[model samples]
Target: MITMKEIARRANVSSATVSRVLNNSGYVSDDVRKRIMKIIEETGYIPSEHAKALRTKQSNVIGVILPKLSTETSSRLVNGISEELAKHGYQILLANTNLDPEKEIENLKLLKSKQVDGIILLATNRGQELVSEIQKLSIPFVATGQVIEGVPSVINNNFQAAKDITSHLIEKGHQKIAFIGVDEADWEVGHRRKEGYLAALKENQLRIVDEWIQKGIFSIESGYTSMKKILESGNERPTAVVCVTDRLAIGAMEYLGEIGLSIPNDIALTGMGASDLSKYVVPRLTTIDLLSETTGAEAAKTLLEIIKEGNTSDKKVIDYRLIIRDSI
Candidate 1:
């Protein structure tokens, strides 16, 4: 295997300088960086992770713990985290907890045991306890997509975003607005979005009807099933429906299409998540952009700053927006 020593010799720089460039630690002059890159490319040099860890007391690895990676929402967040970490010569160790508290805690221990320098968590309610545990370990970690008390977080304003989307429907002459989200007992995202929905209606002097609110998993199948249940009940079909996530919105749309319901004419549909898939669907989804990419990037940056500054007392909050489309 091509080694850093050979690259250093070829680049006419010290091995330490070559190592610094490769590891993204310490400073290398522009000339030295260019020469090292050239030598690395020509020699196909690859640094040994073990050796780098010995030098920096860092594994060059970050743990990314998400509820699940099966959905596009988590996938996009991971993409953003990976992109930022790569720029800093860091590798991501992904852990899918399947929204299980035990699994998430287990993964946290494993990542710490492996000596990862930092972690980014897309957390649920159970995260508050896990984060409290992680804090005691003095490990650098950031929560993305959801917030927990007493920990730094990178979150979109889910409450405000949902409120804005709901208010828009109300302004468009829709008196009865339905909300579909996951069980609030599990995910914080669902809870906050639901809060926003209720807040908007309450502020507008509209009755908050329990019959109009639905909860299930944040999946297309769940959305479809829940929406079907709502339709079957014959309990005042809502003029508009707001979903907690884009996947749910898409699923609800599919059901609406099957039942010969015209979107925005018979019933309007909208959801959270600015995922690309939302654009391709017919009567393209009207949704909110969570700025998930920025959230991920900022999480990495904040974690790195915490690691460098040796401080964990700060938190970061990102904003969200409503992206109107043909759906509403």
Candidate 2:
């Protein structure tokens, strides 16, 4: 392996001069930099990141804790994070918790031990245990998808997004609207979204039936099962339904199709997350675009800023777009 010393020797420069050029830390003449770079290119010499980190006390690595790895939202967010971090010569150490809350805390401790410069958590819930664990970490931490008090986060306005979608359904003359949401333990997707749906109904002077509200996990099958129960519960049925996510809405659509119910004609449907499947599904879903990638990029930027500067609590709320489709 060709070392920086060899490159410097061949380029007729000192090792410190090569270091200054490669790290871009100190002043070096353009001619010297060009010569060193040319010698490095010719030799195909690669700098040791480990040695660089030791010298600078910066690993140039960010730790990312995700709830799940397979979801579309997660994939897009990661792509955005990767794109933004690469520009600053930073890489990510991914820790997938597979939707386990305990693993979130565990991953935080583990990543901190690995000497990551900072951490970005795609949080599932705002449990006190998780917040307490985060407070103990010395490095900068940023949360996405959920808010934690006293912690910096990049989040979507779930309440307002849900309210907008519900109000849109009402404008389409949907008086009887049903809601499909996740467990309230997840404040962003579950509690805030349901609160928005209820708020819209109350503001519009529309009646909400207890039977119309159903809870489901974040899954297609869960949505299907929830819809099935809603359909079988009572003689009174909703003219429209608002789901917390596109996956759930797709599952409900599948159930509706199985029951010979035509979308919009029989029941209008809307969902959050403008997923790829949303467009391909029959009667293409009317949904909210939470700008998952933008949020992820923003989170990466925020964490980097905190790492550069001192830690300060800040929250960034990304805007949402209501995507009107054939479903409604």
Candidate 3:
């Protein structure tokens, strides 16, 4: 637990000067700044958040509120945020909201009290209330995944991506395709993906069966249970299933395997995000590549622009690709 005082002693600068260098405050020569940074690094000095908040009146910390850190998507997004923010000399204060709005709101309030410079929200659903609160506080923030009105966000075209995936399945001769996803009326991703699924079906003139469409929480367990229920209902299983995410695809495939079913031969599965694991699955998953890294890079760049320029910009929409692999 090396303190700033130790770093100051090692750098032969006053504690105040060390504090200034750490907070990017008053003029410190570039050479001196470099030396101080080196000393801080060598000393493993942990700066006081309270002191930082007081001197800079900004934490120089970015709040990263994610749905679930365990998921591949959230982890990749966090990695991207880390990579991009590191370049700007900012650190992240991560919070797992567990897809709970109450938790998300609580985390936002805590971050505000801590005086974080800005927040990069990987929020789910409509964040209108949270965004409104941020606006009232005059705090800088940006969202990822789902966008709300008046909030700048970084996300892929979910509707288009889903539409493309569904169309791909249709082109693959999957007329009786099933869509398994989150609840459409609530979750933004669920709604957008469902829109895409419907679009493809309507465009191809394929019948959309109510039984073939299922929605649940975004989890492997939820996917497994929903799929199992779908199977037990004795309704003829479709030739293919379009999962809203790779996690769901993985879970559905696992259950399908256990029931003595084989992929592509019995059923085909398509995932939304082209997660790394998707490539290594028994039958490589055909999916939409969300370009999560590129999205993260762009989000970080946007926030920096807001911080430096003191202005909010339009939402950034990253492009996605339909990746055709063995699963289709």
Candidate 4:
């Protein structure tokens, strides 16, 4: 392993000069800086990141927390985050929470202990415990997919997206619509979406039946069960169904198929997230595109800015679009 001294000796410069050149500090002349850089590059002299952190108080590493790694949404968000962070010479230390809130809190502390420059959270919930933990952290962080008061975040207009999709269904002459949602603990996907669906129905003067609403976890099996219940319990079946996520919608579709019901002909359907599976499924699910990758990229950029320039308590809202497909 070549040391800075060796590189200095090879370049006929003092160790301090080489340090200045490597750190880009204390301004060495351009010609000398270039010579030292060339020698260091040619000799493959790698600087100690630990020493660098000790000197500059920056690890150049960012911690990322995701709800799950298997989902297409999470994967796309990670891709966006990785691309943005790499441009700044920062790497991600990933922590998977597996949809557990306690693990989310634990991972935050663990990442802080590792002295990462900052954290980016793909949050599923905004519980007080998580909010309190976030407030206590010294490092800056930005949340994606959900909003937390007093915390910077990058989020979609989930309420508007839901309302738009519901209104779209209404425009297609769907007066009797059903909803498949998740636990309200997930404010963005569950509560806000339900609120939007209700708002659209009320605005359009459509009657909402209590039996038309069903709750499911973020899973295909849960969606299937919820749909089954809705179909069995309701006296008057809904003509269309709007699901909070593509996964849920897919499950509902499977149940409909098992019952020999044709889509749009018998029942129309819509889903959110625009997951990759949405386009490939038979009839190609009509859904909302939350611009998830853009949301992740923006969250990373926001966190980096906060880490570099101090937190501005900024909140960014990304836009969404509806993808019309054969399902609806």
Candidate of highest lDDT: 2
- Of candidate 2, the 10-residue stretch with the lowest lDDT total is 305-314
The TM-scores, one per candidate, come to: 0.85, 0.95, 0.84, 0.97
Query: Between the candidate structures 3 and 4, which one is better when assessed by lDDT?
Result: 4
lDDT per model vs. reference: 0.84, 0.93, 0.84, 0.92
Cα lDDT tens digits, model 3, 187-245, are 45888888889999999999888887888777788778777877776657788899998
- Residue 306 shift from truth in candidate 3, angstroms: 1.1
Clashes of each: 0, 0, 0, 0
Every model's Cα RMSD, please?
3.7, 1.6, 3.8, 1.2
Write candidate 2's Cα lDDT for 1-328 as tens digits: 7888898889898999999888888999888889888888888888898898887888999999999999999999998898999999899999999999999999999999988999999999999999999999989999998999999999999999999999999999999999999999999999999999999999999998888899999999988998998999889888999999999999999999999999989999998999999999989999999999999999998988898887565799999999999998
Please give, for residues 45-76, the per-residue lDDT of candidate 4 as tens digits. Answer: 89999888877788999999999988888988
Error of 2 at 153 (Å): 0.6
Give lDDT tens digits, candidate 1, residues 200-279.
99999987767678887877898888778778767578889999988898899989999999998999999888878789
Q: What's the lDDT for candidate 2?
A: 0.93
lDDT of 1: 0.84
Segments in model 4 whose C-alpha atoms lie over 4 Å from true places: none
